[model samples]
Target: MAITKIVELVGESKDNWRDAAANAVKEANKTIDEITGVEILNLTADVKDGEIIEYKANVQVAFPVREQRK
Candidate 1:
């Protein structure tokens, strides 16, 4: 039997959407294990003074639920 869990995270980058999504997954991996995949749910941008300041991404991170050891 297998179990899975999903978590939503928002990441920001000054570069682009791809980096934002990648950063979100990378940061999540720091605290999580068995990261199966990431689904990009939404994309947006922050504007400052009529210029795009940063790129933001909403991501869904999926990972396997670890079974507790007896």
Candidate 2:
């Protein structure tokens, strides 16, 4: 059996939501390993002058839990 854990993360990009989502995972990877997947929770955009200036991604990142030690 394997153990998994979920962590929330938010990322933003000037390009698109896809990049934003990818960035979240990329950043998480800096500290986390054994990543299984990511579930996007929400997507939004920043508006300026009635135009979207940035894309935001809210996601739940899943990875294997670290082993416990005594």
Candidate 3:
């Protein structure tokens, strides 16, 4: 049997929503192993002076559960 875990994360970037989403996975990868997939939940942006200053993405990251060690 196999089990997977899902974690929610919000990533921010100065480029675009796609980058923001990718950033989430990249950041997660730094601490997580065996990442299987990602699902983008929401996309938002911060505007300043009539221009987008930052992009934000809400995402769900999935990974397989690892066995525990004592």
lDDT-superior candidate, 1 or 3: 1
Per-residue error for 46 in candidate 3, Å, reads 0.7
lDDT (Cα, tens digit) per residue for candidate 3, span 1-70: 6889999999999989999999999999999999999999999999999999999999999999877737
Shift of residue 67 alpha carbon in model 2, Å: 3.3
Ordered list by lDDT, greatest first: 1, 2, 3
Clashing pairs for model 3 are none
Q: Kindly give the stretch of ten consecutive residues in candidate 2 with the minimal lDDT sum.
A: 61-70
Q: Name the runs in model 1 displaced over 4 angstroms.
A: none
The C-alpha local distance difference test score for the whole of candidate 3 amounts to: 0.95
lDDT of each: 0.96, 0.95, 0.95
Best prediction by TM-score: 1
Q: Which pairs clash inside model 1?
A: none
Tens-digit per-residue lDDT, 1-70, candidate 1: 7898999999989999999999999999999998999999999999999999999999999999878846
Better of 1 and 3 by TM-score: 1
Q: How close is candidate 2 to the true structure, as a TM-score?
A: 0.92
Deviation of model 3 at 26, angstroms: 0.6
